[model samples]
Target: MAQNKNALIRYKTIDKCLQNRYRKWTLENLIEACSEALYEYEGRDVNVSKRSIQLDIQMMRSDKLGYNAPIVVYGKKYYRYDDESYSITNIPLTQNDMDILSETVQMLKQFKDFSLFSELIGIIQRLEDKVYTEKNHRDSIIHLDKNEDLKGLEHLDVLYQAILKKLCLRIHYQSFKAKSPSYITLHPYILKEFNNRWFVVGRKKQKRTNTHLGIGQNFKHSVEP
Candidate 1:
């Protein structure tokens, strides 16, 4: 559901490996396996290499994917989840991977200040957990852009929920020129980002004004509807 490149590759590897029990695959085999799987799923062949698989393993170990299964090697044979209290498949994630993922989770905490929808966060977390890795790969990894405004995430989320539900909202809008916060009821129809700032396009209920909120409204007025 989430269109993360690293996460998708990891998931495909794990799924492909799990689908075949008697089959033992090296990194090379896993790459081919994933290539075939992608061809079947995407209706096109996507080129894959050992480096990509290695990165997938790194990402999974980074714990962003939340899987911790040990693929064991016996002489020439390779198998995952041989014997443990939790099957390798059931391991959830390796400690290292969990640490990385935990850091990711922590980074997301910057949005905790804003209004958020429970369902949206749940969906994001679920998708985040599906990432995995293969034999030759190091682990799965994801790096959020650091120079981005993480705080605006909550505002985006609130706007998204309002738009999805078609619900009007009472928002405390701050205008830089006004020097004070003003309350307005808005029929939030869309959320847009321009120049890295988010805007809520809606109709103001009080003034019955059709407004496009982009660079921040300086003058404050109330919306009735």
Candidate 2:
């Protein structure tokens, strides 16, 4: 039963199933309850078998899941886990989930040349393990990019800090079409990139008024600074 792909559940599912069961559970009934709950939670079908349920019962009984899960024979049937509340963290992952996470970790390691992202592979490995083991799949599909290399790194960092602090900046910027450099005071609001080049989006100080600059703003008024 452990080798079957269709019969595995994490520890949290087991805890929720037992909590939802108001009365005692026979082996057959418990298996049914677990399968149904798993289907509702994960939108996946799980086939519950007697042998599989027996092994689950044994694992629960070993105090491995923080429950003194006991087997009781009433009218010649096996029942287990009489406790009211159990933690989901006590659940273990199926071997398949572990293998999939290991493969993903290997892929993340291929980009170790990026210094800022060096530890990201290990972080993801730990996160995958924690999710599968605890059955905490609430925000499971989330991902992030850790790459940090970019041109004008220090200037970009200063712009970001100014935006976060709601401060204005006076910049000396050299424009390709201009004969000389330009000085501009800008209230930083947003930053964007296009064609591998960075751009600043904000309100620029104009000849008698303040004008907002963005992707669609007039090019003549959008001086680089």
Candidate 3:
């Protein structure tokens, strides 16, 4: 079945709720949990009905989606996973899924000649290597950019979430010329990377913002705001 983004989110929420063996999850509780999770992730209130949760549980329990979650009801009301280690995320990709991904990689390889796609070439190669490794049961042959050792790399997810939620952020930043770091309020617009270094492009939250500054000039300041 082709599931919408919201439906997939609800399924994941239900899976997480049922995975918590310490909590006795009822139908009402599951609905409330799913509603809260959707609100937090999507930044909006979404009504999660009893029927929706029931359908999600039914789908997870079936082989239709390959989840086949061992969801069981105890005390005739509370729901829990029969196997504690069972998780929808832990499900491996099927052979058909691998075939589709391999084809996609091949298609993406055709765009490597374009200048716009230069940055993504490394990412595409990494994805191709990952698929090859999973399918062949061996290590990856291609070595791409590994940013695991890069400084301030951990903040990517939080910055991404802030941008998605349309939320302002207080950033503590330091420049090489600056003696110390300063905190500034920023309305994050986009996250960009150039020359293997990550930077956030956004307007500073200030009354007299320096909008006339060029992109290269703006990066020199200790705190724009």
Instruction: Give the per-residue lDDT digits (tens) of candidate 1, residues 193-213.
Output: 555454667888766667766
Give the C-alpha miss distance for residue 96 in model 1, angstroms: 19
Please give the CA lDDT of all the candidate structures. 0.55, 0.53, 0.69
Per-residue lDDT of model 2, residues 107-182, tens digit only: 7757766875534633653455454434544332212233232234334435544665667776666655567666
Sort all candidates by TM-score, best to worst.
3, 1, 2
The best-first sequence of candidates by lDDT reads 3, 1, 2
Q: TM-scores across all candidates? A: 0.33, 0.33, 0.56
Candidate 2: where is the Cα deviation over 4 Å? 1-4, 10-13, 21-24, 34-47, 63-83, 91-225
Please state every model's RMSD to the true fold in angstroms. Answer: 14.0, 13.5, 13.6
lDDT of candidate 3 over 46-157, digit per residue (tens): 8888889989899899999999999999999999999999889778778888888889878986886777564555455456656766877864343224543233434544
Q: Is candidate 2 or 3 superior in lDDT?
A: 3
- Let me know the TM-score candidate 3 reaches against the reference structure: 0.56
- Model 2: per-residue Cα lDDT at residue 49: 74
Clashing pairs in 3: none
Ten consecutive residues with minimal summed lDDT in candidate 3? 210-219
What stretches of model 1 exceed 4 Å from their correct place?
1-6, 76-79, 83-225
Q: Which scores greater on TM-score, model 1 or model 2?
A: 1
